[model samples]
Target: MDFNNSYRVDLREMNFLLWEQFDIEKNLLDPTVNAEYNKDFIQQLLFHARDFAYNELGPNYQRADREGCKLLDDGTVQLPSKYQGIWQKYTDAQWGRLSSPQHYDGLSSPYIVAQMIYEVFQGADPSFMVYSGFCAPAMYLIERFATAEVKQCFSHKLATNEWTACLCMTEPQAGSDVGAITTKAIPQDDGSYHIEGGKIFISAGMHELTDNIVYLLLARVEGARPGTTGLSCFVVPRYDLQHDGSLIDNHVRCVRLEDKMGIHGCATAQLSFGDNGPCKAFLLGDRENIGLRQLSSMMHMARISTGIYALGLAGRAYMSAAEYAENRVQGTSFKEAFNPRAKKVSIMAHIDVRRMLLEMKSKVEGCRALIHKLTFHQSWLTNLQALETLHPEKSEQYQALSKHHESLVHLLTPIVKAYTSDQAWRVAELAIQVYGGHGYIKDHPVEQIARDVKILSIWEGTSFIQSADLMKDKLAMGRNSKLLVVYQDQVKTSIARNRKAGVLLVETDALELSLAIFVKTHALMGTWVKEQKLELIFSISTRFLEMMAEVTLSWLLLDGAVIAVQKLKNLEDSQDEAFYTGKIASAQFYVNNILPGVKSKAEIIAKEDTSALDATGDMFLQRTDLYGKQYF
Candidate 1:
C-alpha cells in the first residue's frame, strides 16, 4: 500500500452529526465554555484538520512503519528518524493540548472537536498516532487527582508536548488483573517512594520524543492490602529534576522492547524500576488505597479513545476497498455474464462485491455514529461544568442536569470499546476480501490495518471483561441510575421521529424489531435478577451486551437517516444531495441487512444454552502431548 494514499473522511457526515444529529451548538456554545467557537470557527477547524491529516501525517505513514523504534545502548527507546519531524510538526501545532485543563495552558477544546480531529489523524497514520495516545489522559488524571504542586510541575509539560508519559500497569502475571501486581512502592521520609518491579507490553513506555518521560505507575505500597484496593498510583519520572529544574537520572530503566505482530511504529517496552538507583515516585495526592477508584474514572475515556481509534481504521479500510472495487475490473456484470462478447466491468458492478462494500460501509458509519453519540453525551457534562463555573449560584442545578448524561457515559463506555474494536477487525477482513489476492499481500493497507486493529479488543480490556462489567454493573440498573430507562425512552423517541419523517419504513421496521427483542430480553433479565439466577445471567452477559449495542447503534443510525431525509428535501441534486442520499442508504442497509443478527443473538441468549458448562472432563478430549510439552 502507498501509505500516502489520501486518507478519506466523510466531512458531510461529520457536519450532520455535529449540527443536526447531536446539535453541538446547543450543547456547547455557552459564553462560559466556548471562546468564540461558533459554527464558522468549528468549520474552519475541521477544514484545517483535513489539510493537516492529508499533508503532514499521511505522507509519513509508510516511512514510520518501515523504520520502527529501536532499543538503544543506553537503555532508552529511540524513535524512528522519520518520526522526529512528525513529532516536531505535531508539537508545533499543539493539538496534543486539545482537551486538557486551562490551568495547564491547554486548549480545553470540546470533546467533539478533539474526537473528530483524532479520527482524521488516526485515519491518516494510526501507527504514527500511537506515540500520542498517552498525552490527553495523563493531563486529565494529573489535573484532577495529583497534588497542586505535582500538577503545577507536570501537567503543563505533558499538555504542551515538552515531555511525554506512559502508564506502567501490566506485569508478567498482572495483565488486566491489577490486583495481582507485585510492583512495590516503599515510602521515604523525603516525600517520595521507591518503586521496584517490572512492567511489560507498555506502549510509548520509553521513548526519546521528549526531554523527560513521566510514568504513571501503579504499585502496592508496603503493608497495604492485596488486590487493586492495595494499589496506589504514582508519578515516576525517567529523569528526576533538581532544585533549579535540571534533569538527573532516575532508577527507571527500559529493560527491553517487545517484538509485536503489529503497530511496529510504536515501542512496546518492558520497564524495570529501582534497578540501578532509587526510583523516586510521588504519590498521587496525599491519598493511599484510592488509586484504583481514581484510575477507574479515567478508564472510560481510554475506552472511548480506543473506540474512535477502531472507527478510524475501519473507515480507512472501507474507503480504500471501495476505491479498489471501482477501478479493478475482473468479471462481467451479472446481467451480461452469459454473453461472450460482454466486456469486463468494474468489480463494483458485480452484486456480491456490492454487498461486501455496503456491509463495510454500513458498519464503518454505524460505529462512527455510535462513538459520536457517546461523545455528545459527555459534552453535555462539559457544557454543564462551564455553566457551573460561570454561574456559581446555580452550580447545584448544573450538577443535577449533568447526572443522567454521566450515567449514559458510564453505560456506553464498555460497549464502545468492545463492539467497535471487535467489528473493526471484521471490517479489515472484509476489506482484504474485497481486494482478493492483492489484499493478502503486504502491497495493500488493509492487511496491515487488520493486524493493527486486532490488538484493540485485546488491549484496555478484552471483550469478555467489558461484557462482565456491563452485566454486573450497568444491568443492575440501580434505583438512581437512568441508564436503562432513559436509554429505552431515547430509542423510542428516535423511532417515532424517523417514522414521522416518512422515509425508509423497511429499515425503521427492522430497527423496531431489534428494539423489541431487546425489550423482551431486558424484562427477562430483570426477572432473573429478582429471582437471583446469577448463573444464567453471567452465562449470557456477552450475548446481552451484543444485543443491546446493536439495538443502540440502529437507533443512532436511524436518527441520522431522519436528519438526512430532511436535508435532502431542501437541497438540489448535487454533491450535497448525494452525500445526504448516501447517509440514508448506509442507515437503511445496516438496519435491514445487519440488524436481524440481533434477533438471532437475542434468541440464542433466550435459549440459555448450558451444554458447554455441563460437559465433564472425560467428555472433552485432553491433549496429552501439549500437557507433556515444557519450556526451559
Candidate 2:
C-alpha cells in the first residue's frame, strides 16, 4: 500500500535527472531567488513527497478504484471515506502550493522539484493525483490573468487546497475538437455572465473533499461568432457562497459519471449548467476572442504534466519488471539459466528479458532527463530576473533563447505526450511478458500497470492527433527555416564533436551514408512543402519526428558521455567508475543500435509510400471479408 516505496526507484531516477544530469542546483542559486535553494532542500522535499505519497495516499488507491465515486440524487458526489483523510493530509502538508509564489502561501519550488514530487504522487495513485494536478493549473490561470479581487477571493483558497478546480472544455458534441462547442454565456446585469448548456468528460467535476469547486468553463457568448473564435472562458463555482464565505448549492449539476477503461477512481462526470436556473460565472482575461489562446496557456502545461505522468507510469512498469525479473524463477538451460548448476534461475538471467528491461530502462531514463531539462528551461523563462543577473549583457539574449525554447517545447509537447505514453504501454507489455503467467493475473502489479498506462496515450490527445499536430502546426510553424537551421547546426555540431573525440561507434562510411540520406530527405521535404504536397508531407512527418527524436537523444547521450568521461578520469571508486562507464555505454548503445533506424526511415520517406491512403472502403471491406474473424 505504500506507493512511496513503490516509486523509490523512480525517485532515484528523478533525482539523477534533476541534479546530476540537469544541474538544477546551479539554477536555483541564481540571485533572483529570494531565498537560497540547494540540494539539501530538494532532498528534504523529495523525502516529504515520498512520505506523503506512501503513508497518506498509497493505501487508498486500490480502495478508491474499487469503491469509485457515488452521485446521489441530491446533486452531491460522495467519494470513498479513505479519500477524505488522504485529501486532508495532502492539504495540511501544504503540497498543493509547492510551486506557487511565496506571497500566495506557495513554496516556489523549481519545476524539476515539482515534477519529481508530481511523479511520486502520480505513481502512487494517479487517480488522486489528477484532482490536485487539475486544480493547480486552474489556480495558475487565475493567478496569471484574473483580476486582483478574484485572486484575493479564490487564489488563497485554491492554493490552500480548500477549493478544488475542474477544466470544463468538452461538450457532448465536442471532444478533442474544442472549436465545435456550443455552451452559451449570456451577459447578466452584474459583471458576471449567466452560463448554460452542458459538458462531458469533466474530471473531478463533483467531488466532496473540497468545500468549493472552481470550473474553468468555456462557452460561446450570446450573439458572438461561432467556433473557437467566439468562445470565452468563465470561472463557475459549484456553489454560491454568502458574504461570510459559507457554501450554498449553485446551478452546477452532475448528471452522471463516465464509465472508463481505467483510472476509475478519478471521477469523469457529465455536468449540466443552469439546470436549476442560471449560473453566475466570472470571465477570464479581457479579450473574448482569446478563449482558445487563454486555454492553450494551461493546455501546454497540462500536456507537459501528462508527459510526466506517462514517464512515471513507465518508470513504474520498468521497476516492476526489473524487480520481478530479479526474483521470479522460470526455466533452465545455458540460454535461459536461472542459476548456476541449478534447475531454475531468475528471469533476469535470460538475455531476451534483460534486453527488454534494458531497453525500457534506457527509454524511460532518457525521457525522464529530457522532460526535466525542458522543465528547467521553463522555470528559467518564468524567473527571468535571476537569469538577467547571471548574464547581464545577454539578458535579452536569454529572453530570446527562452522564447525559442518555448517554441521547441510546443513542438515537442505532442511527441512527449503521445510517444512516451505509447512507449510506456510497450514497457508495460514487456513487463507482462517478463512476469510470464503471473503477469496476466490480477494478483500481480503488471496487469494494473499495463491497464493504467493504456489510458495515457488516449488522454490529452490520441497518438494520431499528436502526429497531425507535429506535422501541421509544430513543424510548419513560422517559416520553419529558422527551426531547420537550428536543427542542422545541432546535428552538424554533434557530428563534428564526435569525430574530434575519435570514439565514433558507427563506421565512417555508414555515418557519411546516413548523413547523406538525412540531407536528401530534408531537401525532399522542402521541395514537397513548396509544391503544397500536403499528403506527402503528412506521410513522412511521423518518420521525420522519429528521426529527429533519435538525433536529439543521440546528442543528449553524447553530452552525458562527454561529462562522464571527464568524471571517470578523476573518480577512484568502482561504483563511480561503473556509473561513468554506463553513461558511455548508453551513448554508444543509442548511436550504434538506434541511429541506424534513421537511415531506414529516410529511405522510406524518399520512396513516398502512400499505399495506405490509396486503399478504398470497398478494398478494405473486401480484404476484411476475405480475411474474416479467424484471421484476426
Candidate 3:
C-alpha cells in the first residue's frame, strides 16, 4: 500500500456519528452554546484537518519512527530532521488550542469537535503528537489548581505550545502503586520547595522543541505523612523564571532515553531532579497532600485521550486493510478455481478475507462509536454547565442533566480506554493478516500502527488496571454504583427504543441478552466479595470488563444502526447509501458475532475457575524434571 494512502478515514461515518446518530447540533452546536460552529464550519474544519494530515503529517509517519530521537550531551534530545519544521507548522496552525478555553488564547471549540480533528492529526502521525498530548492536561492542572502567579508563569506557554510539559507521576518504585512514591520535596525559606527524585518513562521529558520543559512533579513534602495523600504537585521547570522572566538552570537533567519497541520518535526519558543543584519549585495553589486529587483530573483526560489515540490508529489500520484487500489480486474465486479460463480476483472476493475485513471494520467502527459517545457526553456536560450559567432560573434542571452526563462519562472512561486500546492491536493485527507478508514488513504502515498502538494498552494504566478500576470503583464492588446503574439504564433504554421501532430487533435482542448476563455477573462478583472469594473476582475482572464493554459497544452500534436505518430512506448518492448500509452491517456483525462472547464470558465467570490461582509457580515452567532436565 502507498504510504500516503495509509492515513485516511471515512469522513461520512464521522459526519453521520456527529450529526445523524448523535445529533450534537441540538445542544452542542446550538447558537447559544457554540455560535460559530455551524455544520458548514465544522465540516470545513474536518476537511482542512484531513488535508493537512495527508499532505503534511502522513509523509512524516515512517520517517519519524526510523530517525527516532537522539540524546545530546547537554541533556536536550535531537528529534527527526523533519520534526522541527512539522512541529512549527502544527503549532503555528493553532490546532493544539482548539479545545482550550478562550482566556488561554484558544478557539474554545466543543470538545467533541476538537477531538474529531485531533483524531485526524493523530492518525497521521501519533508519535509527533505525543509531544503535544500532555501539554493540555498539564495546562488544565495549572488552570484549576495553580495560583495566579504560577498560572501566569506557565499556562500560556503550554497552551500555545511555546513550551511543553509532562506529568511526572511514575518513579523507579512507583508505577500504579502511586502511594509508595518516595520522591521528596523539601521546603525553603521563600515558600518554594527543592524537588529531589527521579522519574522514569516520561514522554517528551527532554527535548529542544520548546524553550523550556515544565515538570508537573509529584513528590512527598518533608514532614508530610507517608503514602499518596502526603504527596503534593509542584511546578518544577527545567529553567526557573526570575522576576523579570529570565530563565536559569534548575538542574533538571535527562539522565537517559529509553529505546522502545515503538513510537521511537517520542523521547521517553529517565529524568533526575536536583542531582547537580537545587530544583526549586512552588506548591500548586498553596495546597498540601492533595497531589493525587489534583492529578486525577489529568489522569482522567489522559485515559480518554488514550482511547482516541487507539481509535485513530485502529481506524487507519482498518482503512488501509480494506483498501489493500480491494486492490491486491492474489487468488481466483472458489467457484472459478477449477476453471482454466477463470481470471484472478482481488482478495476482497474471497469469503475468509471478506470476513476478516468485516471483523476489522466492525471493531474499528465500534471503537470509534464508543469513543465518540464518551466525548459527546463530555461536550453535553460542558454545554449544560454553560446553560446553567446563562439561565440561572433553569439551573436546577441543567444541573441534573449535567450530573447524568457526568455519570455516563465516569462509567465509560475505563471501558473506552481498555476496550479500544485492546481492539486497536487486534485490528492492526487483522489488517496485517489481510495484507499477508507485505503487512509484517516495515514497507507497510499497518505493522508500524500495530507497534505504536500496543503502548496504549500498556500506558495510561494497563488493561488489567482499567478492569480493576471498572469493577471496584465504577461498578462499586460491594454494590451497584449509581454510575453503573445509570449506564445500564441507558443501554436498556436503547434496546427498548430500537425494539419498539421494530428496527434492529435482532441486534437489540442480542444486546438485551448480553446486558442481562452482564448485570447478573456484576451481582455475582459482588457476592464473591461478600464471601471473601476475592481471588476469583480479581482473576476474572478483566474478562468481566470485556463482557461489559462488548455489551456497551453492541448497544451503541445498534443505536447508530437505527439512525442509519432512518437516514437510508433519502440518501440519493450511492456513496451515502453504502455508508449507511455499512453502519447497519457493522451493527449486525458485532451483535451476531462479537457480542455473544459476553454470554460465554458470563458462563466462564460463573464457573469460578480457580486453577489459575491454584497453580504453583513451577507449573508454568517447561522443565520436565526438578533439576536441569530435558525439555519436551
Candidate 4:
C-alpha cells in the first residue's frame, strides 16, 4: 500500500549502453564537433537528472494521478496541485532544452543523450512528462518551417519552456485518418488566417502551466482540395501576442476534458477554435497545402517518443518486480520443500518467479538496446548533416553516408514504436504477476504503469498502422528497399563478426537462423504484393513487424555480448564482472528463446490461411443459438 516513490533505474546498465555498447565517444562525442558533451559533462548531467527524477518527479507520480486535472468553470484547466511546483522546477532546471538548438537558449545535447535523460524523467512520471515533452518537437517544426516573424515570436518561449505546445491534428471524426479533418482556415487581409474547428484528444491542450499555449494546428484553407493534400499547418496560439509580448484573447477554448483510465495528470482537452470569437493564426512557412509533409518530422519524433515512453514504463516495472522478488519473502526454497522447519526464502528463490523475472529482464534490456541503437543512428545522422553544412568540399560523401543513417532511422522508428510498446504491456503484466494480488490495485505502481502504457500502442497511430507503414512503405522499395537492404547488411555483418569471435556460438547461430527467417518472410510478403494478396499481407503485417523486431534485438544483443565477452577477461576481479556476465546471459536468453519464434511466424505467413478474412459475422458471435444450427 505504500505509494512513496517506487520508481527505480539501473544506472550501471545505462552507463554500459552509452560508453561500452553504443560507443558515443567514437560516434558522437568528438571534440572537433560535439565538444560540449564529453564524458564528464554527460555523466554529470545524467546524475543530476537521476537526482531530479527521484526527488522532484517520482514522489508526485501517484499523487498526480490520484488528484488528476481539474477543469474550472472559467474555461481554464488546472493540473494536479503539486504540478505547478514540479513544472517550475523542471523548466527552471532547463531540462526541457537539452536537445534544443543553442541559438534558441538550449544546450544542443545529442538526441541519444537527451533520450536517456528522458527515460529517467519518463520513468518517474510519464503523465507529468506529457506536459513538457511535446514542446521540443513543436519548436523544431517552427524553427524549420515557420516564417521569420512567427519564429521570432514563438520559438524562444517554446524552447525555454516559457510556453508549452501541442500538435492539434486529431478531430473526433478523424483520429488516425488525418485526411478526413474538416478544420477550416480563412485568409485575412493582414496575411493571417482565422481558424475554425474543434480538435479532440489534444494533450496539454488547455492548462495554466504556462502563460500561453502554442498550437501547431492543421486545417484546410478555403477552396483547397480534399483529403490530406489539402491540409495546411498553422501556428495557432491560444492568445494573440503584441509587439511587447503581451497577450490578448484569441478565442481558443477547452470545450471538454476527457475522463481517462490513466495519465490523469495530463489534460487531454477537447478544444474549440473560433467557436466564440475570432481565432487568428499564421500558416507554417509560405506553403498552404503541404501540411502533412511539414508535419512528418514532428510525427516521426512523436513516434520515437512513444517508444521511449514505453521503454521507461517497462524499465520501471522490471525494476519494481526485481526489487520485490528480492525482499518479499514467501514459501520455503525448493531445496527446503520437504522440511517444515526450514526457513522461508524470498520469492527470488522460486524457479517460476526467477523465470518471470528473467523474461522481464531480457525483454527490457533488449528493447533498450534497440532504442539506443536507433537514437545513435539519429545522432550520427544529425552530426553528418551538420558536417555537410560546414564542409562543402566533402558534402557529397557526407550526404551519401547521411542517406544510409537516414534509412536506418526510418527503418527503426516504426519498429521501435510498435515493438517496444507491445512488449511494455507484457512486461507490466509480468510485474503484476510478480506482485500477485497487490499489483491489481492502486497501492502498487505497476497497475498505474500498466494503464499509462496501454495508450502508447493505440495513439501516435496504432501498432497496426506502424506495421502497415513498415510493410507497405519501408520494405516495399522497388527492387529492394534501401532501409531493408542496409538493415539486413548491418545485422549480417554483426552476425559474421561475432561468429568469428567464437564466443556465444549457440546464440549467434540462433540469431543467424532468425535472420534468414526474417529475410525469407520479407521476400514472401513482397511476392504476396505481386500476387495481389494485399489483404493477407496487411493481415500478417504486425507479425512481420514483430519478426523484424526480434531479429533486430537479437542482432544488437549478441553484438553487445561480444563486447561483454571481450571485457570479461580483464574485469574478472572487478565489480563489473557481474554486469558483463548479465549482459551475456540477457543476450543468450533472448536469442535462444525469443528469436526462434520468428521462424514459426514466418511459417504462419506462408500458410496464408484466409479463415479470419473469410469469417462471417455470425461466426464471431458468442451465442450459437442466436445464429441457429444452420449458421453454426
Considering every candidate listed, which one attains the maximal lDDT? 4
Candidate 2 local accuracy as lDDT?
A: 0.74
Each candidate structure's TM-score, on Cα atoms with residue i matched to residue i, is 0.95, 0.90, 0.97, 0.97
Cα lDDT listed for each candidate: 0.83, 0.74, 0.88, 0.90
Q: How many clashing residue pairs, candidate 2?
A: 1
Candidate order, TM-score descending = 4, 3, 1, 2
lDDT by residue for model 4 over 1-632, one digit each (tens)?
24579989888888889999888987677665668789989999999999999999999989998989888999988898889999999988999999888888988899899999999999899999988898999999999999999999999998988899999999989998999999999999999999999999998789988999999999999999999999999999999998886899999999899999888989999999999999999999998999999999899999999999999999999999999889999999899899999999999999999889888998999999999999998998879877877788999899888888888999899999999999999999999999999889888889999999898998788999999999878888223676777987898899889978888988888888888878888888778778888898888889889999999988988888899999988775688888888888888888778888899998898899998789888757645455475433
Task: Give the poorly placed runs of model 2, Cα more than 4 Å off.
Answer: 1-7, 333-343, 385-398, 477-479, 487-523, 572-585, 618-632
Task: Summarize candidate 3's per-residue lDDT along 1-632 as a digit string, tens digits.
Answer: 23444678778889988988788877468788769989999999999889889988889898888889998887678998788998888888888888777788877788899898888888899988889888888898999999998999999988887888888889888998999888899999988899999999998888888889899989999889998789899999999988987999999999899999899889999999999999999899888999989988899999999899899999999999999989999879999899988999999999998898889989988888888898999998888878888999999899898889988898899999999999999998999999999999988889999999999998889999999988888888837678878987888888779988888886787788888888898899889988999888889888998998899888888998898898788776776788888889988999999999999998998998999999997767757767778685
Residue pairs clashing, model 1: 1-443
TM-score between model 1 and native: 0.95
Q: Write the per-residue lDDT of candidate 2 for residues 1-632, one digit (tens) a residue.
A: 33223443445556656666567776544535645457887788888888887777766666666677888888788776678888887888888887777777777777767887887788777888787887678888998888777777788777767788889988878988888999989898777888989999988788888878999989999988887788888888888766897877778999999887667778889999997887888888666767777877788788788878888778878888888889888777565345677678777888888877877776776676667656776776666656677669988787787776676567567767776777778888988888889889866666777877788877776777777776666655213455556556655666676677666435333444555666567677777877777677776666776666666666666666666776777887776676677667766666677779888898788787888668677755443455474332
Cα-lDDT of candidate 1: 0.83
Badly placed stretches (over 4 Å) of model 3 are: 1-5, 621-632
